[model samples]
Target: METSIRLEQAIKKLYIAFHNNHLNPECCKQCAVGNILDNKDSWKHLSDHHGSLELNYVGKVHESFGRKFNGYSPLELLKIEAIFLKACGYQLPFHHKNSKPKNPTHKDILFDGLTEVITFLCELDDVTNIMDYTKLFEFKNDKPLHDITEASA
Candidate 1:
């Protein structure tokens, strides 16, 4: 099967399974509290003048970046993104049960950001070894698998 089709199918199954009821959170309070960590002032401070802080262990490094967001460097942007991802339960320490999967034990289901998942999966597959990029991105040269069939070459 084409990578795009397979990806879509896999994602559909994942969502269907999740919707049927299968996953749950490992740490409700931690995840929830982390969700709204906007107020830096209330956080446990770590730095001096800059007043930097640690959001979630080593996974996130929140810093002032010395200027406004527009002035953020590449490294600083990376740091900010990392913190947000961890806070949003992306690279979570534990597996949460899906409250809506057919197979409640199936934790592979994800409801948001298939592109990110596809990208990560491609990485985990070790891109150098993947001859079939078609089966990785779940898209055919940027277009979807179904669209490929529906449209002509």
Candidate 2:
């Protein structure tokens, strides 16, 4: 329900990118973190390699200074991109020789990537996964779980 401003903004951007055919696993400006950062590829400089968890010198300096782009640390942006790429079926450290989906832009492939990225974002914000619907099917004492809605209200 209650989400950080940055998380909410990031989710909205991702949602728009997904539906608008703007999400791309291979394009730095169209990837998950890029979309979250308003289609900017500057986040790529945070790491020496795409999908790498280690921060480069510039990234380390930003992290040390508490610099946040779009409310996410440089390291967080790298992690988000890594998660998206991995879930989309790409081998880490994205190289032309690395394994990747037959059609990286396919809706199914993008959806899978977005799902994982969203889950990671939720974890970062310490919030329930917005895409998770498992709670709607929950049951207790052989009765449907109806208390969540009531509690939310």
Candidate 3:
């Protein structure tokens, strides 16, 4: 998929994830990029891993490039949020269920943090070892494994 299309889908998922997570819409306003920045410490763990220091630093440094936006627009930042949510298996059309996969769990939050950090690294132009980090962001295909054609009434 094209990067922009993927980004759009990711953004929609993020909005849904945030809502399903019970985050205040007023605080996030359908885009929680500012909320993430406001709670940077919570997200710091995303890059706390030993080898992730470089990747984390690269993101921050790149963030510095755009004085007004921290090197990314609000949409771009939201895209990162979407990437994080997706990494933790946040699919669309959220529904109430009696079993697992109902809402974002604590584990999902931590995984999201890690995903955000890794995605930042992936966006870097200088990074050459993308394969190593790509796996961290992998997600199962959302499309059904089997196709079912519609049946005429």
Candidate 4:
């Protein structure tokens, strides 16, 4: 399926980060949006608090002007980070009192976060979730509803 250049690039970066063990929920420079932005923590300045959906003054101005970092708006970046953090088991607006996974860097934990982020990215691009496998289980008359080749198309 066709995807925006930004989406494709973002996905590629995320995939690499995931496999390279560079993804971390607590680090602004290594989170999902961070990797998409080339591991920069500058996006953190767009919001006053980490994992917050609300935008600050700078973020508002950038959003109003249609500014995009690595092809994502300031708001989109915030949403992506929030999603990642939540999926990784962190409470919103990350803080010392917030509950989080005991092993934040665990592969399974990171994978869960990556799954959600990829789903969101696909939604933004109006494409099917690349990580979805339910179609392979669909059946009609006890036969596979989607052939492997057709599903891959």
Give the root-mean-square deviation of each candidate in angstroms: 14.1, 2.1, 16.1, 1.5
Output the number of the TM-score-best candidate. 4
**Model 1 alpha-carbon drift over 4 Å, by segment:** 1-16, 27-110, 113-115, 126-147, 151-153
Per-candidate TM-score against the hidden true structure: 0.24, 0.93, 0.34, 0.95
Residue-by-residue lDDT tens digits, candidate 1, 117-136: 33443343344322234644
Worst 10 residues of 1 by lDDT: 27-36
Query: What local distance difference test score does each model get?
Result: 0.33, 0.94, 0.40, 0.94
Poorest lDDT segment (10 consecutive residues) of candidate 4: 144-153
Can you write out model 2's per-residue Cα lDDT over 35-122, one digit (the tens) per residue?
Answer: 9989989898889999999999999999999999999999899999999999999999999898999999999999999999999999
Model 1 whole-model lDDT (C-alpha atoms): 0.33
Error of 3 at 135 (Å): 13
Ranking by TM-score: 4, 2, 3, 1
- Per-residue error for 8 in candidate 1, Å, reads 11
Candidate 4's C-alpha runs over 4 A off are 149-153
* Model 4 error, position 77 (Å): 0.4
Total backbone collisions for each predicted model? 21, 0, 1, 0
- Per-residue CA lDDT of model 4 for 1-153, tens digit only, reads 788899899989999998999999999889999999999999999999999999999999999999999989999999999999999999999998989999999999999999999999999989999899998899999999889996558
